[model samples]
Every structure is written in structure tokens, then in C-alpha cells.
Target: MRYAYYPGCSLQASAKEYDLSLKAVCNRLDIELVELKDWNCCGATPAYTVDPLLAMGLSARNLALAEAEDLSVIVAPCPACYKNLRKAGKALEEDPELREKVNDMLTEHKLDSIPKVKLPLEVIASDFDWDALEVERPLAGLNVACYYGCPVARPKGGFDNREAPQAMHLLVEKLGGQPVPFAYDTKCCGGGIVFTRDEISLDLTAKLLTKAKAAGADCLSVMCPLCHLMLDAYQSQAVRRLDTRFDLPALYFTQLMGLALGLGREELGLERNMVAPFSLLERMGLKV
Candidate 1:
């Protein structure tokens, strides 16, 4: 169950909790994550916008590093990172000329082949045997709104369906938690332009929060770091902008999985969440 791991920029910083919970859950599952040496950023959202070639080169560098390790699969927790890496891998594999140009940019390393880019969600869904998993504290009463954001199921022909994905729902059911029907599950979080056009991002995030709350979701189960940032870190701004009272907590799916597996709060980095779930967990008779 070993795979080359890419934490990306967000996971190392603003989304550190995601990284922490992911490692904790993986450790429990006996999944070994061999992180790539000298791994760099995957260019995230802004790289391609500035220069398409540069974006490919940046992501390709990391792929080259992974290829050097001889690992066939590389898992990126951040959706943006996954999207960039996946795009770069596909481009480099399909277009030899483009790969050469990008290789020229990578003077120190050459990309003979690119590794398969997978999201952490994809890894958990495809690799693990759900029936064999031990759930010490089942999420019996919790209703989770599994938000995939945009990039996760996108660029098509991936693991889950582009329109109606069910991996998260199945995982929630497996953990004894109810997965609420969320129409905006694939909606854009406006994370790409969140910094430039904050108003648009806030409005979009507010809509998601309002919709999730209306659907009776106890909390949002998210997999993307940017989506989590928009939904959790900037939730207050969204609420204030909309003049609404949506105090929904946005949690990484790994965090919820850790809780179901009887992992401690601190172990999962639960305290780092902007909108704390302590009250919600306490209400559900779950330890905080």
C-alpha cells in the first residue's frame, strides 16, 4: 500500500490539518506514504494562468522526481495540486514534443515517464477494503454533505463520475454516517479567483454554506484544501457578507474518518479547524 506522496503547498501550510489527519488515517490503515525527495509545488491555480508551459514544467518536475523513485502512483491531497499534476502527466505522456520542452526547463532532471496522479480520496476509495475496516466509534447520527468542489471529479475519465459521484457517499455509509443529497456537490468554490475577486468567492461560498445547512448536514466533508479554505477559513466573511447565520463546520474527510476510527482530536488536528466542530461533536455524544 505504499505510494509516492506529494503534500503540495497548501497541505504544508494553511491546510496542515488535512496533512495531519491524512497521515493519521493512513497510518491506521497501514498505508505507507513514501514522500518524494526535493518535491516542489505543483503550481496550484495561478501557475497555468501566468504561463501554460511554466505550469507544466513546475508540475512535471515533481513527476520526474516521483518517476526517479520508480513509484507508479503519486497521491496529492490538494485537488488543485492533483489537477495540475494530472494535467501535466497526461500532457507529457501524450505529447512528446511538449514533454521535451518541459524537460528542457528541468535541466537538473529529465522526465522519462510520468507517474499516475491520484487524489487521496481516490486512493482510499480504490485501495482499501471497506468491510475489513474497524470503526470503533461509528458516526451514527451525523449527516455529512460531501463536497467535491470542482477539480476532484473533473478533467473527466477519472475515478468518479463527473456529474453524480458516489465515492464519498459510499464511504460515509460505510462509516455509519448518513450522506445528505447535496445538489451543489460539484459546484465551484471560486477558489481560483478568491484572492483577486473576494466578493465572488464569498458569494459562492455563502451559497454552498446556506445550501448545506438547508440540507440538514451536520458538517461538510471536504477533500480539497482550497475548498476547505473557502468553506471553513472564510466562512465568517461569507456569513457577514450575506447577513446570514450559517455556522457550519467544514472538515476534511480524513478528520471525520479519524474520529470514526477512534483517533484522538489532537491526533487528527481537529483543533486547527477555523469553525470548530466541538459543539457539534459534543451534541452527537462524540468525544471532542
Candidate 2:
């Protein structure tokens, strides 16, 4: 099950832990990830707001590279990247004139055909045989709140339900972890405005933390790095702003899967998480 892997900008720097854990889990599942060489930024959220064509072209450039690689499917770990790539791919495939315009922007590589853009969750859920994989350490007593944030199940026609996604929940169940009934699973974490309007972002992040904690979730299983950053990295700020205690740990879903698969903490980059899950893991009787 080989697919083109695009780590995007966040995974290389702020979300290295996600990249590490994703690779570890993929390796364990025998899912080969051929990373596209010289892959550029997917333009994330900023470029599209500034100029729609520029955003499409930026994402289309990466798609052109994947087409060159002869891979039918391109899997992006970052939801923002996946959204951009998927949007651009669909636009290009539907409109020939738009494809020509974008191709003109690409001086070096022209997109003959845009590859199918997919989220890491989409690839993992559809490809693997869950029953065959041995679960060395089942997450028996752990309660996880799967957070999709925005962009993950958005823009419609994607893998999961845009309003009510259940892919992460099913994966949690498969890993022997109980998926808590979280109402704000698809809620925005204010990641788009975290830098410019931190007050608003903090308020939103605080609310999410509050809800997840209230739901009795031991930790938040997030798919997007931006969501993880707002929930985990900026949790202290959210706590200070709201004058509340939110000692919740935000972990990548891949990290949880790795732990259940008996992969060590070092391999899954567990130490890189801002909110430490050591105590939580200890409670689960799992080695950290």
C-alpha cells in the first residue's frame, strides 16, 4: 500500500511528533510512504484568503509533483494541507481552463493530471486490516476525545461526515480505547486566528479543553497539528485566560495507535508533546 506522503510545513517543524508517529505506525502496518521530493508549502489558510488563484497554484504545484511520481494517491498528515490539495485537485480536474492557467504558473512541472488528495486518516482507515494487526497493549481503560477541529471533515464530499465525523472514534475503538461522546469534536480551535487574535483563539481553545475534560476524556486524540497546538501547546495560556485548570494532554491519533501497537515512547515521539501524558500512560498500565 504505497502512497505519496506530503508532511506539509507544520509536520517538518512545529508538528515533528506527528510526522514521527505517523511514520512509525505506517512502518508497522507495512504502508510504504514515498515522500514527494522538493514538495512546496500547500499555502495553508493564508494564501487562499489573499488570492484564490495563488492558493490553488501553490497546492497544484505539489499535485503536479505527485503526478510525476506516478502515484495515484497522495496522503497528507496535516488537515490544512489535505484540504488545500484536495480543493485544488478537484478544481483542476473539473475545469480545463483553470488547469491551464495553473499550469502556466508552473514553469518547471506541468500538471498532466492531479493525483487524488487524501488525509492520513482516510488512507489508514481504508487500507489496513484491523483484525490482522496484533495489539500488544490495548487501551482498555483509556477514554479519548477525538478532536477533528475544522478542515479535516470539511468542504463536503470528503471521507467522513462534515457535521458529525466518526472515523477517529472507530479507530479509537479498534485500538481498544473508549471514545467519549464529545459534542465539540468538529469545533474550530481558532487556529486560523491564533497568531493575530490570540484572545479569541485562547477563549475557543479553553472552551474545547473544558468540554473534553468535562466529558471525562483522559486525553484529546487530534488529527490536525494546528488543533493540537491550540489544545496542547497553548493550553497554559487558555488556562490562564479562563482562570481554569485544564491539565488535558492533546496527542496525535497515530501516537495512540503506536502505543497500542506496543511501539515505545521514543519511537512515537511521545516526549515531544507539550502536555505530558506520562501520568496518564502510567494509569493505563502502559510504559512510557
Candidate 3:
């Protein structure tokens, strides 16, 4: 499968591992990703909240760029980017007024067509030939609590089931790992509230982590970098604030998949995460 890949702002900076691991996995899976040139941010939560048109305009510009490349499909690795882009494309695909307004904003890149925006997880789950896939090392006993994050299945009409998505579960099994079903798989992690409403965000994260820990998950396999920051980075602070002991490391699903594919830690940028995955994987009887 070939498509235009948009790494977004976070992937180029804080979430470089997502880019590396995703590209590596795509390569192994025979998926070609040609990056959309001069792409900009999809205007994530803040822009969408401030102005829906502004968000759609920004996301639409990227879609227009993909159209310039003669590409009809775009794969966004970030959940927020996927949501924003998919939302914009779907909106433009349906509403001509929004499409014209958005096309007007992008004088440089005209929207000749609205491309299909997709998440890597959905693409990989549906397209990748799991039966033909060969893993270097099987992750037999690793228990993973899949965290899809808020925007992933939100606004209710994306690709998969909003409330109870199983793409991650099936992917975990494909990697030879056990998927641990937990309560907060699709719960909100309190994005901006992390800084604005510290207590609320921390408490929410603590609650989610508590459930995953209770489920006997070795670590949480996540798709969104923001959720990784909240669940893995702020885990210690949340534990301290909640006065509870929850030691769970969160890794991108791609990182865990890379491990199962026998890729080295550094190659997948495993060390980029705030919560190091080495100890957790080591504890799972894997020689990390």
C-alpha cells in the first residue's frame, strides 16, 4: 500500500520514535510512504477549539498538497493529526462551502480533490498481511494494555468502533503478545488540562494507570504521543499525588512491534520515551 505520510509537528520533534518505528514497520510490511512536501500542522486541539474553519483550513492545506502529488490517501501517525485531517477531509468531501473556504485559504495549494486521511493503526490492521508476517522474536508473555487515546475513535464516525476498538488487540496478538483489556482504553487523558488543570489531569491519569496495573499489564502500548506523555511521563507525579504505587511504562505500539520484529532498541528510538521500556521488557523475560 502506498500513501502520503504526514509526521506532523510532534513526530518531527518530541515523538521522533513514532516516525522511525512507523516507517520501519511500513517498510517491512511493503507499504511505501511518500511525505507530503511543505506540510504544516493540522492545528490540533487548540486551533480546532479556537476556530473550526481555521483548523479545517490548516488540515485542508495538507490534503491539497497530497493532491498535488497525485496521491489519494494520506497516513497520519498521530491521533490528533488523524482526527483533524480526517475531519477536514470528511467535511470538505461532504460540504462544498467549507471546501471552497478552505481552498481559498490555500492559494498556494489548491484543493483539486479531498484525499482520504487515515491512521497508521487502521491501515496496518486492515492492510498488512499478518499471516505472511514473520517476527524475529515472539513476544509470548508480554501483556499490553492498548491505549487508543481520545481523538482516535472519537467524534464517533471514524474507521473503527469508537467505544471498543480491537485493532490494537489483534496487532498485539500478531506480535505474539497478549492484549490486556482494561477500562480506560479510549478515555480522555486531559490534554491541555495537564498544565492548566494539573490536579484533574494527574488524577485522571492515575485512575487510568491504576486500572492497567490492576489488569496485570506489563506495560501500556499506546498510539498517541500526548497520551504517552500523560500516562508514562506524568505517571510518577500522578502516583505521588494520588498516594498510590503504580509502576507501568508506556511504549508506542510500534516500539513493541519493533521488538517483536527483532529490531534493536536504539533503532526504534525506544530510549526517547520518558519512561524507559528496557526494565519493563526485561521483566517480561525478554533480553532487552
lDDT of each: 0.90, 0.90, 0.84
**What's the TM for model 2?**
0.96
How would you encode candidate 3's per-residue C-alpha lDDT over 25-103 as one tens digit per residue?
Answer: 7777788999988999888889988998888889999998999999999999888888788878888989998788888
Residue-level lDDT tens digits of model 1 in 64-153: 888888888999988778888988899899999999899999976799967998888888999888877899989999999999888655
**Residue 204 of model 3, lDDT score:** 88
User: Which candidate, 1 or 3, would have the higher TM-score against the true structure?
Assistant: 1
Score residue 197 of candidate 2 by CA lDDT: 95
Deviating ranges (above 4 Å) for candidate 1: none
Q: How many residue pairs in model 3 have overlapping backbones?
A: 0
Instruction: Please give, for residues 1-288, the per-residue lDDT of candidate 2 as tens digits.
Output: 999999999999999999999999999999999999999998877899999999999998899888888998998988888888988998899999999999999977899877998888888877777777788999998999999888555668888888888888999998899999899999899988988999999999999998998899999999889999999899999988776675798999999999999999989999999999999899889876
Per-prediction CA RMSD (Å) = 1.4, 1.3, 1.6
Location of the lowest summed lDDT over 10 successive residues in candidate 1: 149-158
TM-score of 3: 0.94
Against the true structure, what is each candidate's TM-score?
0.96, 0.96, 0.94
Deviation from truth (RMSD, Å), model 2: 1.3
- If ranked by lDDT, best first, what sequence of candidates would result? 2, 1, 3
Better of 2 and 3 by TM-score: 2
